[model samples]
Target: MSKSTSLLAAVALVVTGGVALADDTKVGILMDITGPIASFIPPLQNAANLAVNQANEQGGLLDGKAIAVFGDTTGSAQGAVDAAGKLVNIENVPIIMGSLMSGTTIAAAEAVAIPAGVVQISPTATSPAITDIEDNDLMYRIVPSDNYQGEVLAKMVLEAGNKEVAVTYVNNDYGVGIGQTFIEAYKAAGGKITSAVKHEEKKDSYRSELATLSQAGGSALVVIAYAGDSGGKIVKQSIEGGLFTNFIGTDGLRDEALINDIGAEALATSFFSSPTSPADNPNQGTLHELYNAAYGEGADKAFVDQTYDATFLTLLAIQKAGSTDRAAMAAALRSVASAPGEKVGPGEWAKARKLLMDGKDIDYDGAGGSYDFDKNGDVSGYIGKFVVDGNSYKQTEVMQ
Candidate 1:
């Protein structure tokens, strides 16, 4: 072939390769939009979308290319695995955010991300086991682990003057992990646990389970389960069964759906702990305002703010790394989140973005609180306690 023909072939090859390189920066959002966790899922999904939109509006990462793909985890281990696989294989997304449930997150990390070299940042998966899993450097979470929350719960119950507590938890990673830690802490703190019951999810009724706790005669009942319809049923049944003891709950029960499902009257006397202080939280107010404007009222849920912060932090990491390479992005995540620098809040993304552009490192103080992520990607934040009154939660105290 002549020199002209050879030059034309080389140009075609360059253009084709450019198209492939351009596609490599796409980000994946893997979330639970259905199943038991749907109540919390929508808001978290909205948060992720809001972060991506804000980033793009501010000129995006890596020269105007923003996050692209979104997939649903369906709130199951199997579903998360499948979603991660699809995102990594079909969508070719190197960076993924999601699988909120600990079990589902672990499954996705082990079954898909680690093997595929995809970086997964979970906004709400709190099981300590997640970070403890061997060779799970790719896994990260924005929320404090159940280990801290469990100890917080135990201290909350102890301070509430509850000496004997009855524990009831959902038989899953999130539930069991917190429950076990709470038990250990409570016992070590000189409190006695009268009984422990682990219930399966999707049960029609927890009347018998509640009966067991009621009969245990504990001063307070600590529930470690998702605040889904089933959890609501259990709470209501426990209340109606004349188990009027004080109720303590973890982050999993910090959802609005619980009040809606069990009605305000039944949930009136309950107290629960969440990762953030929503009532006086400046970040929450900003998120609420933005969310209400975009999706109307009642869009902010327990993990929604953390989810937003997690996405923003990931984007910031990608910008810091100057590429979407999963491994580099993962290291950047640790660098940005782990302390010793300037703090950035939810509404201050523009400033953070500017600093990033100026080649200055930043530490993001998320809506969830001091997001000083450890080497294992776990955050340390104060747990806020709330009391249910009517259809809303009123922040009572900040548990240190």
Candidate 2:
């Protein structure tokens, strides 16, 4: 169908017995589409769309086309709540796929999804705080928590011979969770934190913070912020001010927009740590080929694999539950995502649907990892060490 027709079809909503039309199964997709993480949205959208498209092409969802209803969490807590409200109350989605930032995801979950009892699976919200939320099994994320990422990143930095570093992180959940953990881990492992600063976002300049940190005499700056917002600006201003030369960063700062804004030459000595797939996940290669074929590029973009996996898993849960009953989603999700079932990989919707129809269990191993969700609705995954390779990043090592 044409883009216009597809959109029109999406909005042709009708209600019957408190459920949507028989020909449509709507899935809510909450994304940070227009705020600090805007640069990360496009490819991630493609990944989510790819899952919906493949499901529709394969057999559709529960006898109808799986329509993706997106709610743009404008990268703020209020925005996230509002967006999720629409998805749950207005759209009446049985399941939700995201709100990528840690702050947004937690806000939406607390204010909306949890109370509403709609299952939410975040593709990329990695804040350690999420692991401790009183979600009652309604909240989940495909990526590992930032607690893991932070510990892994500390080892990556220390292993790179940066014994002392100045730290600057945006004063958000994403930044604070990873930043504090990294500092604690770094110091515990015989590294020194010269200075640590938590700054607010959208400031025109971070020169004053840079001056203080640069004067701390650290060999490197460890930045923990979104590249589209404070993180990119800090890196750019640092270069312009001739501040610290070497940098260590977490997933938030691994964006290509950083390289584009500051140029890769400035970050030659820098490296990043991000949630990554297993080094030997052959399904990753399959997902990449299909992704590139669909969008022409960006198969390797950050969170693309995770986003696709999250969406696909949500669909699988809905299908396994046999209806849009919100209460059934939690158990259905575990049945499809946890182990001891027939193995289903990416883009195997038809095969999975057939297995479910045959009253058999299926375990969905996606491009990112085999999602064995813990009791907290979190997964264990790999963290990758990356460096700028041309305009994008290249993973140099995978740490479990």
Candidate 3:
């Protein structure tokens, strides 16, 4: 029932949602489209576009068609507040999918989204700090927090047989949260860290920091930073300066740009970690089919699944609310996510709408996996170990 049901439901939704859409409704997109983590946003933005397009084809929300109006966060907190302010006050969107980075997501939630009562869902912000934000249930994220990813990452590093390593993290919520967690987990797991150093992003050079980290001569270096900013530069400088050869990083460094910038030969012995779906998740294959048909084969990329799921859930919540009312939409978010009525997944938009119209509840299972949101609006998921193979990095292991 899992695979076949998902496939048939997907095909039906695709066919129904492919027709010309009529009315127009807007959903906000807050991202780092061209900032520090810029490389990650393209596929994510495409995913958002794909989901909204599919929704419109499925007859949109209520009598209005869904649209993704974007605002760049510049990959910073203040940038997020500015972008979110425009989205809430000007665009007046009921829901926003954005602030891919953790700091920006927090900023948007506290300073803009929550106060405005606009629901915000992040596709990639995974800091542990997000677990206790007082958003009054207005903020949500599709990815598991670093609280989960960090421990899983630590386990991966230890299991890889690297007992002693040096650590460097960018100075931000994403880095600090994951770094501390990895440190504690690594130490507890009988691994020894040379020293934990903090690095700032957008720096032209990290040679000094790399020198300090590799002072004691370590077998591996763990870096938790954005690829476009300090992480890629650090890896490149480390290799050229002969400070360190083997390197590791988190999702922030898991990008094609990193490999291109630093070259594959340098990262051949290194690895990075990021969140991924469970092997048994029933939605991924169908999502690939829909993605390939719309954007061409191989168009699907990182965060595409979560981006699609988050976008779908956002619009569905507004549909469930039956209005653009912010509070009502926020209240409906969990109902659309968890179970109680008809089971829904990607390409099941029409089915879901019918169920809702019939006064039945619906559970939205999507590309990433089944989302059973905890009280904090977080979910349990898997993390993958990515290693460089020739010119790009690919998932080598996925751990829950």
Candidate 4:
């Protein structure tokens, strides 16, 4: 070959490689990295990033690579609106996975993603309101609604022999959703709530609310709030004031951030409910093994499994659609998510890619367990009880 010919051929190769890299698809990560639930974002972010990397390793969706474009929800509705606008308008992501909080997820979906024709899969937005929203079916969640977790929590409380309790919830969709459900279930289950108060977030003190809540003098104080923001404050102030010694918290309060605030010793007598992987699901073990290898102790991390599942399903839908067209991607989501297909277990991206390439159907049973996304884009899953033992938090029970 002539020298010029060889040079031209090399130039062609370089240009083609550049085009391939440029064709890499962007998957928006709309998580509360800087907002209220900031403490929960790292591990959850790690889980989503891991899924994207796995897809890239398996040649990504349709020969193009996958990448995650992050946006911090800042733990506010306006923050989510702005973050989602950036993702849909500027980054041009076909789909997004996050805004882990319910209010942020709803705000972003209604104000940004739905109208803009982008799909959003929430990893941890468990509010029951999500099930009833007119989202054009663009919003989906990997975690079960608060309706399930709340009832189970009530049962757990009753099982512990508590007859009546006082409750305080953050003034937000998540807190209200779970709080209302807990109230109904607790009452129907023959338990009484002596008091229920709604408080705003970012407040420096919750002593007034705590004082009122504890006035009833019950066995426990149920705190329905996030651990990073008001939830942590409530727990600390509640303890400092020497009000309610025993406490029960929901998923929002289950975090290392809370422990940092109140210390492990302070949380010893308390327990909280959060989503979990079923022990019978071997895929959970497999995915956790891989997750922990890279990011230490990722197995029990809140929403880690749900985040992985959400990201994985989004990429799979993209591949199945063969294009980034919004309608096509949405159409392909449920079909690929449920039914008679080859079993693809968690952390099995390469395997899933191979099956799709061969024109075979696949049924993905992820670390969060098998998915059958209902018409409302919701899933039914398990919630676990988290209790502090010494310096660490351990899940003591996996409620069905």
Candidate 5:
């Protein structure tokens, strides 16, 4: 071969290698699209897409490299692990945002993210154990943990003059964490837990369990379960059996579909605790308007905005690190979320972009509230107390 021809071939090979290397700056989303939590999952998925779209429209993250892939967890632990593996191995994405359920998030953190050194940010997983697990430096959650929500729910029950409370929780990390915390806090606050029952998910009937709880001598019953067909059936059966006069729930039971399934009457005299107020978030007006315009309805009260914020935060970290290297991005996340800098909210993407171009640091206070991540990747937010008003929930108080 001639020397000139061989040199041209080598240059062509370098150009091809450079293009492949540039394409490595991909981001992945793992969410629950079809499962028991399907109703709440769609809005979150939409919010994530919206954030990524907005990011790309504004010249994309890391100088227009752009995010590349998205996937679903199906609201299961094994499913989450599989999704994470695909994102890291197949899609070659270094950052992932998803797996809304606490159990699934924890499973993915341990089985996939921690070992692989990928940054996993969850928008709705509230279990304290996610942050408490040993060496979980890669796992971050956007919402407040169940530790605060459980305490808030316990206080609401006691303040309502209910001295005796019975508890029923689903058999999962989220359920058990909230239920145990509430029981401890309620007892510590001079209240009594008459009985606590843990029910397995996907069961056909909970009538016998309801009967057992009814005989527990409590005037009020608190349910810590996911909101969906299973929760709807349990509430309907409880009301029909006249097992309890009042009911309460954690954030999992805040789904609007629950009311549609069991009707307003079944939810009468019931109260629940949510992490934040969707209607009152100052940072979410534009997001809410956009979601309504796209979906032809308001976004659900689940952690959709938080999901959006989590995805954006991950991208911000990638920009700050100036690379898709997972370890560097994980280290940058803590600095970008905490104080000593300007706060960025949902509608301030343009501002964040400008600041990034100017080489300025940003601290994002998300739609869910302050994104002040501690060493454990947790933040503090208020718990909202809501009562059933016809078919909707009316916010009665804010528990801090």
Candidate 6:
């Protein structure tokens, strides 16, 4: 694990509210904690630990406490495989929650989780490619696929008067899935793309790509990349080179790091699209209250609600299964998460446990959304339109 990831994990474990037992049940946590999305991991790690700590405080997992064993997918494919191998083969966790990036999630699933017969749930792996994985119901994600977000973003861009734009995306599963989908939808909706470039991540500069993209004039630049990696660099270089003023970004680019790196004033005219919870769901308010009380801040961080919900639901699935039997997880998860049962919201582990003990069903309407998973283990969800709000971003509208 990287130094930052190790520090965050230590912080989460140290500040967690409960004491862990020797007979605790270990659950695997896979995340891109090192390379690109490092800035987004601390709050998400806190959310995961919150779920585990909440379960421990509320009478634990199957037979004892729930312990989170993390695996840092150094933001690469082989790194994901190695980390997942350690979780499944070494720690022997029955289930895993994580791998927020689409690339790492897919790689870990295809290479490790499926072969090991371990069920994995993701909070923010939004690639359209994940919808078609032949996992036999072992893989699940709480967020809507990038296919949905891509269509919504196309409409958002067009409606925002960006008739012409230059598109650039990182060359990875995350960027390719949303970038191509948005390109097709944008063109179909009569929007014009003056130029589009697929760039690699971790480069020191995007000046060459910006120069190429600037050769064709456009209204704004549509960047589909992580803010900590290629996206922030592209936006900064674009502004520095006077290539484009207005910018449009997807979820990967919608990090607080972006606003911090590129001043809020420069990004005032920029907008972003990301998976957001249903506005009408009161569970979100409950989660926010509990989260703020626990951590004192960061209740509104990207994917914090979804991460906590995923971890909590994973624990609930273990409880519903009554054992850590790998094959039984899928049915147990569906039974506890879908309808035809008593509704359970965030921070209600004890209630959910009692309901399961009494032979009752549960519908886990999470802080993110009601995760009534469809045939592909994908849920229909909301996408939010956001603009820079001081040091962070704020949702101005919810797009279904």
Q: Which stretches of candidate 3 lie over 4 Å from their true place?
A: 1-23, 298-300
lDDT of each: 0.75, 0.90, 0.81, 0.83, 0.76, 0.90
In candidate 5, what are the lDDT values of residues 1-400, reduced to their tens digit?
2352233222211111123345436777776655677777656756776777677666767766555355566677887788778887787777888778898888878888888888888888888788678655788887788888888888899999999988899988999888888999999999999888989998889998888888877988898998774566678788788777678887788888788887788678888898874456677776677667765664545676788788888778887787777778777888778766677877566778778668788888777767777788787877888888876777788766
Instruction: Tell me how far the alpha carbon of residue 27 in candidate 3 is from the true structure, in angstroms, after superposition.
Output: 0.9
Sort by TM-score, best first: 6, 2, 4, 3, 5, 1
Candidate 5: how large is its RMSD? 9.1
Measure candidate 4: CA RMSD. 7.8
TM-score between model 3 and native: 0.92
Name the candidate that leads on TM-score: 6
Q: Which segments of candidate 6 are over 4 A away from where they belong?
A: 1-22
Tens digit of lDDT per residue, candidate 4, span 168-215? 898889999999999999999999899999999889999999889888
Q: Which of the two candidates, 4 or 6, achieves a greater lDDT against the reference?
A: 6
Task: lDDT for model 1, please.
Answer: 0.75
Q: How well is each residue in 202-275 modelled by candidate 3, as lDDT tens digits?
A: 88988888888889666899999988888888888998888888898998998888888888887888888888
The local lDDT score (0 to 100) that residue 358 gets in candidate 3 is 75
Q: How well is each residue in 44-123 modelled by candidate 2, as lDDT tens digits?
A: 87898899889988998897878888887888899899989999999899999997999999999999999999999999
Show model 4 residue runs off by greater than 4 Å. Answer: 1-20
* Number of the candidate with higher lDDT, 1 or 6: 6
> RMSD for each model, in Å, please?
9.2, 3.5, 6.6, 7.8, 9.1, 2.4
Clashing pairs in 1: none
